[model samples]
Target: MRKSNLIFIFLMLIIATSCDNEEAVSEQSSTEFSSMQDGLITLKSGAIVEKKGDDFYYQSDMLLSQKQLETLNEHGDFIIEEPDQIENETEIHPVYNIPVEANEDGPAVPRAFGLYPTPYNMWAMVRFVYAPNLTADRKNIIQQALQHWEANTNVRFYNATGQPTVDPVYGFEYPYIEFVNATGNSSAVGRIGGRQKIRIAAWQATSVAIHEIGHAIGLRHEQSRYDRDNSININLSNVHPDNRHNFNKYTSNYFAVGSIDYNSVMMYDSDAFAINPAIPVMTKKSDGSTWNGGNVLSNPDRSWANNIYIPYIARSDTYRELAPVVYKPDNTVMTPSERLALQAQLNNGNPNPPNCCRLPNNF
Candidate 1:
């Protein structure tokens, strides 16, 4: 894969946090592998298995002869097993530049509110850690990513007067994209409208930016190990020997009910490091189909801006039109029923939360 693509993969791994813990458990049981598929063996426990060489045993202990063990040890420890898992963590961040009324203020209402008159002709604001230098290759990559979005959709990437120092008058906002001189690890944030923030890393692959952009436009991981039949190609000889013993330590708790796709851009490169032993296979659709061309808006070589909605605004015609409205209650203390009603309203249709104004000190 190209360096840009690799960087994108790393970014995806960084931004994509596993929702559940992956600490390894004591060896519950062991199973022997009888066959290899795509260079990996599948054990009885559903863990993908691999052998380093003729001398290495699939089990943790040195089950092979002394000479064989020495020969295999030179190569690296064998991978006996690994779990099929998917990450479920969600990214969270505060909406920048939006003002909140004091608790003493009256019911908070949105300052400026309304949807764009048109459905698809929306704009997006991208904030980076640093401005892209004119000569930097990243500038091209960023431009490509944006153009990719503009090509198919009716959206446009607007040039703002200044970086997103404060909240916008309207529309969606993203973190500033900075160009770091050194390579290895870089990150980007994909906030779909205002529902959630998805961070993307730059070190692993260039496509990482594109992948996070996909999330920003509402695409989920394709290969969720949670689903059955997810698989990846592996070279047994290249398996990190010492890391083999602790493989189970990285298994995610989430599962997807689907078949696997090996060629997904969402999948990690074979040589990439697995922070936990049970590295997740690239995510896939529940049915196991690879991502079709149109699925992603931006790619490593291109940039595109489009409008995609989360569940809260599913009913709204234009996602860009929904603004956060704050409400402040006159009475400091809200009755239990009122609190429940407020929560229901927020959950049901209103995107903004109710801001409580002044309250009695005792209450």
Candidate 2:
């Protein structure tokens, strides 16, 4: 399987870089895997599932800091230590970034939370379930967050297709996200396989949901990029002790994409994890400013998202444009059935089947 992807990638990389300027290609394709000369790495296990290439990531765990994932000749332990059962935990950072330390287990190979080598292919039918008790507005907020990601890049987040009569009361039977109530907002870094979650708190602003969806779509905080030390300063003394690690800087080993994305939605804010507002934890060297780019998707953020997943966005996947707009004229959210129907109308035919290895989702 890796061989075929490598072949396809070689052709695609050549075709994508044939433009007069090679810098454009590098700027666009520099993702965790796309930027590498090494082929993408596929994992053999996830939090609980043993399926090959299925895994999840949290923003604060071991996989967050590598300049790039070297070949997985040495597959480390599951980067994030998930709870024995997600249901047993009230809340968790299930998706945060921390340094990868090579222990007695030999050396640590860089790996993203989960493998999402084909995110764009699975974008149209990304399945998710909101906690039933959520109010209409709260559900709308969640849906709005999904649409925000879709609009910025070539992706979609809609109701799970092919409903089953019996669904698991607690979670889905397949790879899915459960947006349940929790103290603060959190989500798995990527497709963790099987049942995963995005816990939303009542007080979290809509932007928080947007940030969490970034994780679900396989993104880590921009400030935590392994190459971030070159762009900003992370002051540990000002940051609260418990959250000090969050400010850890990646080394010179990391690769950078785009003109340093200082205003990405994935960046931590100026006062993040800091006890004193006077002391800026992350000071931007460009102007000695603290990070403040989390409002909306920055140009670099959108570009990297598309580039990382570009392998799946066929120049011919025009049918995706036909996918129903998640937001209505008045900013209301659309349902999955409505989006499907719109897609059918646009194709004047049947939509594509599960091109990716998506599991059954009756539950």
Candidate 3:
């Protein structure tokens, strides 16, 4: 079967948000929630998602949609490829609002079919809004995290606060992220469609916001790498059974870039999901000692973001040419001369650029 869009491995859980209501889901411990009335949704492709209330979830926090679940039911095999191989024959130039037809079935993040392959899902330029109910403190934390990403990677976040969620001229609903307050932190693995949330709690640190944004932008927990066994050994015995799935290694279907990163903000600490907080549930294979995962974006994290995204300036006009001022993935701004050179390469120096463009202030 054709592979779906690329990237991510899984962490975090989001409570189902209704179409009209943005109320946060009650903060319930994952262990307790797992023991609550829940149903396991097993797909024909052998993918499993947990159904609690009206939402479906994979691993801990990556939300799964019914359409994505249906796609999984139709196709099964997904091969993990290197980062360079992500732009294979099937891959297209990352563009805004372009439709991509592919099956989204498999693990979350990093060179896999699991990511929503549609251009709208690819986050050409990350656009976000702060929920009105969000407090100033949480907003400040989010801003700090945003600064960290901008400083380290090519990922750019446009603050769409006080902006309309729809395009006034074209009447298309714009895809955008909304930062909302919740009891516990959770976010959809990648862009799942319109208005996905990055739920933050009062107790979370700026580092936590950074991590959730990683998920929102399509980076999964570092431990979910299928080859994680080579780097760290999981002590399933010490883990709570309901939360054990959080530590489950991804299959070959999910791809990764570079070796396992202990310092990646995406990684879980050694005691993550541990039944006894003081007991270690994971340890480095080489040393047999637990490690505290890092809060900053590691080198691999920066490389991954740089590889997958290109910064663009949102515009209202239907100008398809690369923006005159674009940001490279290495946190460097491209010169106008360089932008024109790349634009020439992309459009064959066509005077008339494509007509479809990311609309300004849309979502």
Candidate 4:
């Protein structure tokens, strides 16, 4: 995984967009439709619409009236606002498309034998762009984040000497980390081979970078809104205007089953001015476990990493049981043990398993 490749993956995940059919609004005479006092109209499906009474509407699969035709022409011959917005004036959820590519080879190897070891001796280069008026102490917050992960995960961080490039390869091997400053409007964290890089928004706080690093290490978003049983109660009629886009996008791939952790460091607290009410508050685990509320990784987070990390790298039988599906194009498929063995060889310096399981590839 070269740095360039890692960046490409991150870009694909965060910036990719897809096209969907826009729902057309049926229009009526000004007399038939009343001017909305709230400046918005709510539709049955929970979509929000800006009322342009008698302004324009799509009819019979095309712009009908001369006024509607003119409005379409003025707007460059396309449906301007999303239909969901018209139906629900309060909040419109944003949709994220996860790229699923077909494996040119065969089905991915099973976790029992196919997992790869994490690159050791590599350094993650961290960089921050703070607001011009940000206090000097604010920068220290990033260091604190690094120290926090290192103390918990046993990884090391290194400082880079010169301007960072979008290099593809990471450190000499694994276990080392690097930090760099990137100039861009996007705030994200990525890993290249052995090195990890984070780009920060100058006006944003450092906590965002810390969260990105967690992504770099293969953690998924904690607030997956897809599971109906996750205990989220969103008010379809009164959603915050700012979070409408993201709220709509929450789904199973990003969220997990039976839980949504609002306190996850990886979650976004605010977008624009409206606070995202859909964000789930962290509750003690079903077993009554608790996590420190600030700046620290919680027990579930740590346990999740512990359970998945080693298998992610080593692909031992135990690790494979943890990750049964190697998501690929066309569908979510099960991985084979042989594939896991190969991956382990590619990743772990020594793919040979301990004396106990010395069969064939040894992994």
Candidate 5:
């Protein structure tokens, strides 16, 4: 039997320059990979990545920061067996966790592989700033994407445009995301600490912004799950040589939350990286069907976010305030009474705890 595309792969970079012009550029043609050249580097974990220009990449779209490279270098352990299980109604969300290092924040809890962990890497509320140079269209795309996430999941974003990067009163730097214009779309997987960029191209849609934000909040490509061969098959020969690495699967270290979700915004479309524009690079194993990559959060996608993130009012106060809207793990809004009860549970039996500062109006 020819070897399946069940391969373990990592960082692969594609370099392009950022453009500040207000006009939206036309989308890259289907043969966009034809002119690409990439550089490769191997990390401490034996995962090889592509280094292009000044940035390192994982799976071509996820930008890797120096700190993220270090974290991957330090730990390479797995907690679960290979997930041969398929998606069922009761599917459990599988996430990656590393042994915690001693730090002021408690030991890292089990989180999605490359997730921003609590009290440190994790955001109290995901803060963001629009790049001053971003065109109006790009900014609007970002705003639409942000609204989608807030509507479906417990994750909330604070508009910190024109705000200082540091807490003016406390003198501590804030971890935030900046939406910038680039020739291609990409974002760091999870929070890479301090300030990170989510690069959106002029021609990309709001869905692309949604996808990159999913990465910034710690989700990997659904198709990259280790056991995805059971759900879909890759036509390796049909893929571009440089882009074949994009179809590589995650090993045991990266866990799957549920069965392969065809609707996952993190999934690549049927023709992604295809050598022939009309031929599919991915097809369903069950029926040989081709599916489009998701444009919005699916049920499993919302469930994954709700499982990991807590909605909070962004503030510099000693006391943490749960946002008025909280989503249950089932992606349902909690009843007012239930929300109050949970609020009390989070705040030491005080449903209406005193907040240190005024809550921002944006939330």
Candidate 6:
């Protein structure tokens, strides 16, 4: 075997040996809520989401649709060498809309995925285990990748002795990840309420595992954000026809956080979707540079996480709508006076300002 492979094996054995006595921290959700109920919206990937108090969820878990969350998202992975490795291709993360009755923090301030920061508290404790077929090297790679997330954020992940068939008495809901055999690296974003899978191909396991975990923690690809066009120029003409849809920006739901972060862990490398090897699909505008993607969490990556999972504020009986993630055609939000003016404008188009209550010409 090559020296690098041998050194890797040694490292793997060390990690595995160190984990020999690794105890599983058993737990359950700290927050209290009514029984799980059906949500009003259905996503393109068929994940069902609803609002329980101020938070949104997929059944019992708070998950949003990747397509719809574009209004909010603007945020995975696959094949090692293939150019088609993109979130829409290998994995689909969800994003929930602002609650009909929003929260005090408003819908936009905090809470998105079940990663470093979860709503139950400030940190999402993830308990995970390995598939029987998983080799030691793969295990080492996966655990180390998880450590990167742990080191960077407030979130934490555990290596379970076995699959969590039930909730941890002291931890969050089935907060477990199980490694499985798969073609490419992919992880369902957020907790799916059970044994979530982080599929990794052994060949390029480390980086891919980190990328998938980034998705698991509720982040979308940087290039997929609503404001991505402002920074990177996606060369759709040079992109493969089958992979073109990956370039579409948000139309259904949310807005970008502040600006486009070119070096996010969630962003794609420049040559990722090229039709030909030499044809780059994404290019930067500032200096005509190409997005190569961050091998580790960039400043924006950490800041976005800090912003999404700041502190958990329980849902109140009386909802407080902070800022609207989506705006009505009248360009009005929850302020009382704005609503009254909107009524007048919609009723007879009376006294409408140039900017306010102006629907598009088509509308």
The best candidate by TM-score is 5
Q: For model 2, where is the 10-residue window of minimal lDDT?
A: 46-55
Ranking by lDDT: 5, 3, 2, 6, 4, 1
What TM-score would you give candidate 5 relative to the actual structure? 0.75
Better of 3 and 5 by TM-score: 5
Q: Which candidate do you rate higher for TM-score, 1 or 2?
A: 2
- Give the poorly placed runs of model 4, Cα more than 4 Å off: 1-138, 154-158, 163-186, 189-206, 240-242, 249-258, 267-294, 308-363
Error of 1 at 107 (Å): 46
**Cα lDDT tens digits for candidate 2, 1-363:** 234333433433343333211012233323433433431234332111111122222234323212112212123322322223232221211211112223343333222222223322122345677667765656767877876777766444545533442346644345566777765566665554444567677766778777777777666667766556766877788865546545544322122332346677777787787788878877887789665766776655554454333212222234333333444311234467755543444344465533554333322
The reply for model 3, stretches above 4 Å from the true place, is: 1-48, 69-120, 318-340, 343-363
- Candidate 6 per-residue lDDT, tens place, 1-363, comes to 234323322432232222111123223221222233534433334333444343343322223322223222211111011222222221111112121223343433221222322232112345577888987767777877876765555344555655455645745445457777665566656554445677776676466777777666666566766556767777888876545655655322222334566566666789986778687888887787776777777655664453332111112221211112212211222255544443333224343323333211110
lDDT of 4 by residue, 1-363 (tens): 334323333332232121112224345533334444433434333433333333322210111233223333445322233323222221111222222122443332101100111221112222222333434443465567666654454233333323243333632333223433434212111222322334343444555545645654434344323432343433434445633433432221121212344455544332212344343233334443333222355443443333222222222242212123332212233257634543443334344444442112110
TM-score ranking, best first: 5, 3, 2, 6, 4, 1
lDDT of 1 by residue, 1-363 (tens): 234323332332333221212123223211122222333443334433335342223222112332222223333322211222213321110111112223333323111111111111111333234343333454445456545544434333343323463456544333333433333222211321212222323333345545544433323333223332324333333456544432232133211112333343333343343444344322233443232322233221121121111111112122222112211111123345543443344344443344433212110
RMSD (CA, angstroms), candidate 1: 20.3
* Overall lDDT per candidate, in order of appearance: 0.30, 0.47, 0.61, 0.33, 0.65, 0.46
TM-scores of all predicted structures: 0.32, 0.54, 0.69, 0.36, 0.75, 0.52
Question: Which candidate tops lDDT?
Answer: 5
